[model samples]
Target: MKHGLLWIARALGLFALCSWLTRRELRILCYHGIWDGPGHYGNYLFMSPGKFRSRLAFLQDWGARVLPLPVALERLAQGRLPARAVVITIDDGWASTVAHMVPALEQAGFPATLYVTSYYAHNQRPVLNVALAYALSRWAAGERDSTLLPLPGLGQLNCPAGDAIALHRATDQVIEHASTLADDDARQAFLCSVISATGLAQDPVWGGPAFRLASRDQLREASAKGIDLQLHTHRHRTTCNGTSCLAQELADNRSWLTGVGEGPFEHFCYPSGQYQASDWEVLRRQGIESATTTEIGLCRRGENPYALPRILDGESLSELELEAELSGFLTMLRRISRR
Candidate 1:
């Protein structure tokens, strides 16, 4: 019944959009990882390549003009966007993006911008949360038995292999709460406490392999392919307690991007779609011309370029849903202007 209501809402949304979008506006579609099969860590975070391609085709069929990021930004500034203008942006320099999504974009003659996390470009492994998720899922399916691992402060722990789903949920909650910590020390303290309290060291699911990050070579190869590399923060840090910490985060990111020769980077993506007013000020001072947020709206001429909005594209959106997203800008404009 819930699914049925969603379908109904989608249909109604598309109808409203069609009536609203009669002119051209700039629509930016944002994506993260594109995988053939969903990641074991968290399926909701990634979209299948087939769905992504179909979304591209839908935009083309609907008379939307796909432009490069710089071009899109320029037109948006001047309020001279053509009818049905759209820009595609993918976040995270996921390997699947180069292997799967890039080819599709190239074939479609669509230009896109990819935001890369500097830490990942250095080949750092993904956080323990993703590893925990994969391990939990495998354990739940009875695919594995005992696994070994070290928990910070707790030394080593063996995760058991049963009741995988429940274990995964508990681990997820722990990780999510840990993420709210303001700094590395706080995060580490929280994780250590969780590990000590849960006694997960004896569990098989906690001993799985760590997830790998994108390598520098992969990023260079992607750049060679005309994929624009932009900023996504170092360590993917979303928040800091004070201005000094925030400045350090930005500085560290800029330093990494420059050190690796992956920059002249002007665009920034808020980590986890998280940002504060201080974050925006730091971005501006650091020479970032435009920054994207997880906010849901279309880019308009008069909108602040620095706090630009992007639409999240994922498996949940069908072709019709994509249409609604594209046309959503018009609806937003009308609503805002009281037209």
Candidate 2:
């Protein structure tokens, strides 16, 4: 109750301040996945669709002028924006995003920029980590015998063969290696074999569209519905490979986008929000107009286009929390209180 009251007070204070002079900073909101139900199976990267809808409604009801990201950036570049300007961006391609978010967005009449990981969209396979997560969820670590695989730093990691502590460590160890596989096919095959050999029942949802990437049909439909498809690179990691690899990854992402008849990609988002300062040059060279990072702050003019920041909202955030979030008052109080 104290926290709730504090947030409400913060909201009131900001509204009073804004009555005299409005804050013109443009806010970029980032979301990842949207699911109708709770986040499950180590999949906490989702926001409840109902909450997402409510947040949009609140923004619209409060009269925030939501804009497409590219348009918002263009307007901001020109030295102005609508009052309380905001751009909605969802990162990484998830089928639930198309399934649940599209309807919510249409209801709110808001436009969003979706940064899709091209490799997943092109392959239509469950993300290797997500698959690993699902498998790990139901694992009875002592249930079965599978030949142990060499796990790099860990040596001979076993599945359905370790204790509770061992299984936890093994999950991390496996995902790390999966992320390094050269090709998606090899990674998928490796995961499939591991899951099967471990006697783990692959969740039914995994094979269904729920855990897979959005289909080409879905991407085209989202485009028709006013979503901007942007670059998130082919493998979702850029700097891990060299600078040239970064360019090639983006090239692959665009090629996939073009093949689906869905885009003229202009914007980018760093995968896992990981990037180095030097990466800005590579992105600019690729003709990306702007790139957003996981950094948190309102964007302003003269800010580096290649290193823009965003406001993150998720299933756990409530309307009141967002009220305090957008106001900037809550953060201020927290910083002061901390000091």
Candidate 3:
């Protein structure tokens, strides 16, 4: 009942705000994986493909102008986009995108930007989303009991139910410890250590099917279908750790993308959108034309290209809700500014 009331209040607020938008702003919607089956709660990480298709259809029927990322950027630069212009972007080249989103995009005739991690492309490794889901599921199932485990930099991560805050703190420590690893082997070793220490490896779900990344063939197919393949770092490293490491990640991704014929890749989505000012400089030095962050807002003319904002889409939004949300983007921005 509380959740329903909150939704009702938000809808009323959105309606009021939409009545006052300037009528020229554009909203860029960002998405990640599209799943097909029952999903876990708190896993806003993936949206079912059917729901995604319905949302796209709603946008199309409502006269929303769907533009590619490059075209939208060009329009924003020249101040020439239609009043309802919107750009659709998908981050993390998940296999589900190839299996599900591609057909819907092709049928709808919508062009999109896909940001991929070159390491995952080359190694076919599991991504952070998959790992997070695995870890959370294991914790919930009581398969992982308390154990002492040594992290690389931070000491240990303990597993204990009803200690969510402590668990998150330990998880952060483990993440930081693993971030310093030079290669996938080292990183995986660190992750395994964490799993063993937290006693999470005992969970049946951990032994079950792990999510898969997109294959080279899938990426090539997407490229052939006019989806712009862009850089998302080599290993999806968070930038808050160190600028030098972030710079190396950007450089490595640029080289890898070019070598794999995924270029001329000009746009970059920060690995996890956790960047600092120096990180932007590193991207600039790497010759990135534009970069996207998880921040939510509409792009305006003269706005900084290096730190542009994006609205993340997940499972929570229904077709009608998504339409209303997209329609209210400019209105929300204006309302926030007035306050």
lDDT of each: 0.66, 0.75, 0.70
Q: In terms of lDDT, which candidate is strongest?
A: 2
Clashing pairs in model 2? none
Model 1 CA deviation exceeding 4 Å by range: 1-24, 37-44, 137-169, 172-210, 241-244, 259-263, 329-339
Off by over 4 Å in 2: 1-5, 15-22, 36-44, 137-168, 179-183, 193-202, 241-244, 259-262, 330-339
Stretches off by above 4 angstroms in model 3 are 1-22, 36-38, 128-133, 141-163, 177-183, 186-210, 238-241, 259-262, 318-321, 329-338
In terms of TM-score, which candidate is strongest? Answer: 2
Model 1 per-residue lDDT at 132: 46
Question: By TM-score, highest first, what's the ranking?
Answer: 2, 3, 1
Alpha-carbon error at 292 in model 1, in Å? 0.5
Error of 1 at 265 (Å): 0.9
**Candidate 1 vs candidate 2, TM-score winner:** 2
Model 3 agreement with the true structure over 1-339: per-residue lDDT tens digits: 645653665677764456236245667788887665334433355777777888788778878788888888888888887877888888878787877888889999998888888777778765544574456445544544445445455655464666667667656655555656797787777666656655666645344323566887877888888788898888788553433587777777777766444578889898777777877777777788898988877777887888888767777755545655566744475568989
lDDT of 1 by residue, 32-113 (tens): 8764442433443677777778877887887778887888888777767787788888886776777777788888888888
Per-model TM-score on C-alpha atoms: 0.74, 0.82, 0.79
